[model samples]
Target: MQKLKDRVAIITGGAQGIGAAYARAMAAEGARVAIADILDGTSLAKEIEAAGGRAMAVQVNVADETSVLAMAEAVNEHFGRIDILVNNAAVYASLQLKPFSEIDVAEWDKVMAVNVRGPFVCAKAVVPFMRSNGYGRIVNISSGTPFKGTPNLLHYVTSKGAILALSRALAREVGGDGICVNTLAPGLVLSEGVIQNTDMREKLTGPVLASRAIKRDQTPEDLIEPLLFLASDACAFMTGETLVVDGGSVMH
Candidate 1:
């Protein structure tokens, strides 16, 4: 059965990498997906439609309230309802790993804007639509690095930690309205973006693999089922929960 049959889902950063994986997974489950991203996602949307799944691409800077609001409007207009939101847009692969002291102030703010404020603005833009429908699912993408206290990327780790707090607080505020907010924390996966960054892939992969109980590289496919559960009716009774899917690395 199609878990998300007829549901409308908005996936930020859907143009590439893990976000693209989420888009494909949701589309395959019968959701009409809106691929929202600062990058061009038109090709991916076309690809999904060609595969008999419904999708549309919309350009959006998740950190900008106006841009995010416009994106929500576009999706609502095209799909007629907003059922789920995957807050997956972030600044990670592009970052050059460095000690906290060496991190530039401007870079730190940029990371916070996209990693933290992005989700906040996105949720703000879409909540009214979800509230009107009396139903919604918000899956905020966080990371396992924060729990492990991973160094050399303090800003990235801190922003991901904020997502946990954001999910819980938002879940509490929206629970009565039948809106579910949760966090999905994934370990380092060799996504398209990560693969292109040789520094990130080469430096972190071996150590991350050693840390995992599974003792294998995590893939985008590894996250599909967990994402489906959170975005579908299967997770109706659950909110404010952090479902970590990092191959049992950080058993939180």
Candidate 2:
């Protein structure tokens, strides 16, 4: 069954990495996907359309309220309705792995702005349209590092922790409007960015694999099913929840 048939989904950071994977999977499942990102998503959107799916690429800076609101308006104008929002944009790929005290405050603030405020802005911008349609799905992308208190990336971890709380609180505020909100926390996924950075990949995935019950590399593809379930009508009754997809690393 096409779980997302006729749905319109906006995947922030959908130009590459795990967000791109989500855009593709959602498009395959019959959703009209909008690949919104700071980077150009034109090619990916064209790829989806070429493969018999409906998609559009929009440039957006999730951290900026004006940009987010403009993105929501553009998407709504094109698709006629907004059904799902996948908050996947963050400042992780270029993050410097440094000790807590060594990390600069400006860098910390940047991470917070993108990783935390970005989702908040996106939700606020998309809510009115979702309320108008009488249904919506919001899936915020978080990281498992916060749960494990992973070191060397304090700002990144801290920002992700806020995402879980954000998802919970936002869910409560929007549940009455028929909008279900949840968080999808993934482990060390060997996405395009990670795979391209061999040193970073080895440094992160080594600890993850050692702790994981399933001893294999986690990929962006591994997250597709959970994302789909959250975005589908099947999850209407579920909200304010966090699903940690980390191969049994953190059992909580």
Candidate 3:
């Protein structure tokens, strides 16, 4: 459990939900974590401290290269090294299932900016630090809907698809450097941003339990153990793998 003793980690979009869970789990396992998100990461850091673990809050907008770079610098300056990174920040558009013709270009671009470019920039910023240190662990979060093709969330679905592939390619590129990169694709996790709206909940979950073998519903807590497994010493030999933790709902 203390395999990550004194190891510093960066978890983007780590202020709440699954990201928050990972932050706490990593800290519990002796990793000093930096909760990086556009949202003030103060509360998450405080929680870690309350639990007797070390943590810091770094404000980062993953879509912006400057913000991502500065976050990496701040984490390094505070912790002296970065041993792990979990790219978990994400966003969804309000637009519904429509003909591709009716979809707004601006909305599609917004999704790409955050979902795709954000992780890329964050990875680019931290890899150099990891390279010099000779060890790194990265877990990029994605959704399973893309693999099954959700009709409504075109933007959200496609972006996750891209992240899955990106994690694999990135793994192959950096494996020799002792960096293990992988993707954690979660299903219908209930988060603050998600369940707040009735419409959003209905849309995200309608196809989830109905088509799956399991009759149980999934919550944000469902993913904590898996997140811990990858962020800790357990994932050293696992790279370029998409660990689907969707309760057998979506098989790829």
The prediction achieving the highest lDDT against the true structure is 1
Candidate 3 RMSD computed on C-alpha atoms after optimal superposition onto the true structure: 1.6
Candidate 1 ranges with C-alpha deviation above 4 Å: none
Residue 38 shift from truth in candidate 1, angstroms = 0.4
Q: Candidate 2's residue-wise lDDT over 160-184, tens digit each?
A: 9999999999999999999999999
Preferred candidate (lDDT higher): 1 or 2:
1
Which portions of model 2 miss their true places by more than 4 Å? none
Please rank every candidate by TM-score, starting with the best. Answer: 1, 2, 3
**Residue lDDT tens for model 3, 22-80:** 88888988999999998898988998999899999999899999999999999999999
Error of 3 at 57 (Å): 0.6
- The estimated TM-scores of all candidates read 0.99, 0.98, 0.94
Ranking by lDDT: 1, 2, 3
List, in order, the clash count of every candidate structure. Answer: 0, 0, 0
Comparing 1 and 3 by TM-score, which wins?
Answer: 1
Instruction: Please write out the lDDT profile of model 1 over residues 155-241, one tens digit for every residue.
Output: 999999999999999999999999999999999988988999999888899889989899998899999999999999999999999
Q: Model 1 misses residue 32 by how many Å?
A: 0.3
lDDT of each: 0.96, 0.94, 0.86
